[model samples]
Target: MTTLRDIALIAGVSGATVSNVLRNRGFVGAETSARVREVAQRLGYRPNPMAQALANGRAPTIAMVFSDLANPFYSMFALEAERAARRRDHFLLVCHAAKPDGTLDTAYLGAVAGRLSGGVLILGSDLGRADLLSAVPNGVPTVLAMWEDAADHPSLPCVTLDFREAGRLAADHLLALGHRRIAVLAGARGDRVSHGARLEGATARLREAGVLGGATLEEDSIGGGHRAAMRLLEAEPRPTAILATNDLLGIGAIQAAGERGLAVPRELSVVGITDIWLAAEMRPALTTVDIDTRRIADASVNALLDLIAEPDALARDALRIVGRPSLVRRASTAQAP
Candidate 1:
C-alpha cells in the first residue's frame, strides 16, 4: 500500500509537509501543495481514517436518526441532510431509529455511543420518549429536526416546521372549495400524529366553519389510509373531501376513491400534507401542503455542526429554528360535488 511517507519521499518533501497538504491543514505554498497532491495521486495513497481521527482527536462523521425511509418525506430530508453534511467534508450515518410498529428503537441511541460519530441529528418522530435526550453522550452535540414543539426540550437545539400552519393550509384550501363534509386520515388517537398540531389545526377550522367532521385514526401509511378511507366512505353523509396527514395517506385516499368508482376532484377531493415528489404525478395529482424538506435538513445539519464546534453555546442559550409550510394546489382537490 502507498503510504504518506512514500509520497513525501517521491515529492522531495518532509512527511509532515505532505500530511499538512493532504489534510488541508496548516498553510502550505500553493505550488508545494499541488506538487504533493500530484505525487500522492500518482502513488495512490489513501489516508487512514482511523489514524486521522486519532491525530485530530475527533471523528469526521455525524449520525442522523430517523423513522422509516419508506416514506418519501423522510427520504427527501435524508438526501438533503446528506448533501449538506458532505459539503462540510463530514461523513453522514443514517440510522433507522423507529421500528416497523412506529415505535422508537430503545437501543438506537445506546448504539450510537459506541461509534466514533461526533454528533447526532434526530428526527422528531423518534423523540417520543422523554428520556431519549438523556441517552446521547454528554460531549456529543445533538439536534432535533421536524419537531412541532421545541419547547418540550428547553435546552436542546432543534429545527422544526409549523405543523399547525400546515394543517390550517390544507383545511383552508378544502373549505374554500366549498367542501363541508371532510374526514382526516391520521394515526390512532393520542398517537401524536405529526405532533398532534396538524389534527388540532384542521379540527379548529372545521369547527369554525360549523362542519360536522371528525378524524379516523389509523396507521400512518398508504395501506392504513386506504383502510380508513374505506370506512369513512361508508358514512350516512359521505365525505366530499379527505385531508390526509401525509402525502402517503393522500395517495392512498386517491387509490381508495378509485376503488369505490369515485372520480377525484369530482365526487371526492383529497388533500395531503408534505408534498412529496410522488404527489405531483399521481393519476389525479394530489393537492397537498409543502414543507421545505431541503431547508429543514440544511438548517438542522448546520445547527448540529455549529453545536459540535461550540458545545458551550448550548449552555448559554438554546437554539430553535422553525420553517414554514405552504399549500400546493394540484388536481386532486376541487369544488364540493
Candidate 2:
C-alpha cells in the first residue's frame, strides 16, 4: 500500500508535509502541498486507517455528503442509505457538507473524502461538478448520488432517478383535471437552475397540450416556494394550479393558497415532485411524484461499494439510473375551478 513515506519520497517532501497535505492542514506551502497531493493521487494513496482495516478482512465504511440535512427528503434518503449500507455489511456516515450560504462546502469534503471515510456518496444536484472534482482526490472512490440530469455525465460514477419524468407526471396530473392556467415554482441552487430537468419536462408536457405556464425561480425550500406562490396568486386572473419542482415547494404553495382564502383543489391546485415522508403527513396530503428514494439510496450505496472494490470502474464512468418517477395523487389536487 502506498504510504506518506512513498508520496514524500516521490515529491521530495518530508513525511510531515505529506501528512499535512492529505489531512488538509495549513502547515505546507501551496506548491509543496499541491505536489504532495498530486503524488498521493497518482500513487493511489489513502490516509484512512479504515481502508487498512478492510485489507485485513474487516467491514468497510463510506460517507454520504449532502448539502442540507434539515430537508426531509435528505433525511429520509440518509435513513434508507444507512439501511442499504448495513445490508451490504458496510457502515454509513452522513456528512453535512453545505456551507452557510447553502453551496457545496469543499473544505469539509477535502478533509474526509477517502481519508476519514473509506469512500463518499455526494447527494443533490446543487453542488457544482468543478468543486467536487477538485475537492476529492483522484484515487478516492466516489459516486454522485441523486443527480438531477442523467444526460449530463459527471467526472465520477453516478446514480439518479429520471427527474424529468417526475416533472411530467406532476404536469400530466394537473392537466388531466382540466387545469389550463398553470404556474411553476422552480427551485434553484443559488443562481444556477438546479431543477431545470423537472421544469423542462413539465413545460414540454404543458406545451404538448397547447398550454403555456409561467414559471418563477426560488430557493429549493418551503419559504422560497411560499414567497413565489404569494406573488403568483396576485396575478390578474391568477393561475388555477401551481406546479412546484419538489414537495417542499408544493407544500408551501398549499399553505399560500390557504392564507389567500383559496381552497386547494377547489380554487387552486398544487402538485410537487419527490414524494417524501412529510408529503404524505401534510394536511390535505401532498400530491407529488414518488421518485422512490429508497431504491435510489440503495443503488447509490451499492454503486459506491462497487467502485471501492474495483477502482478501474471509474474509467468506465458508470451511470446507473434506478426507479421511475410516479404520481402520488392525493387531496391537494382535483378538477380545476
How many residue pairs clash per model? 0, 0
* Candidate 2 C-alpha RMSD relative to the actual structure: 11.6
Residue by residue across 40-139, what tens digits does model 1's lDDT show? 9988888898678757666777888887777687788889999999898777888887776556575776677426677888887545655555556666
TM-score of decoy 1:
0.84
Which candidate has the highest TM-score of all?
1
Per-residue lDDT of 115-146 in model 2, one digit per residue for the tens? Answer: 66678999957787777777677778889988
> 222 in model 2: Cα distance from truth in Å?
1.2
TM-score of each: 0.84, 0.82
Kindly report which residue pairs in candidate 2 clash with one another: none
Cα lDDT of candidate 2 equals 0.86
List per-prediction Cα lDDT, in the order shown.
Answer: 0.80, 0.86
Query: Highest lDDT: which candidate?
Result: 2
Give candidate 2 misplaced runs (Cα > 4 Å).
1-59, 314-316
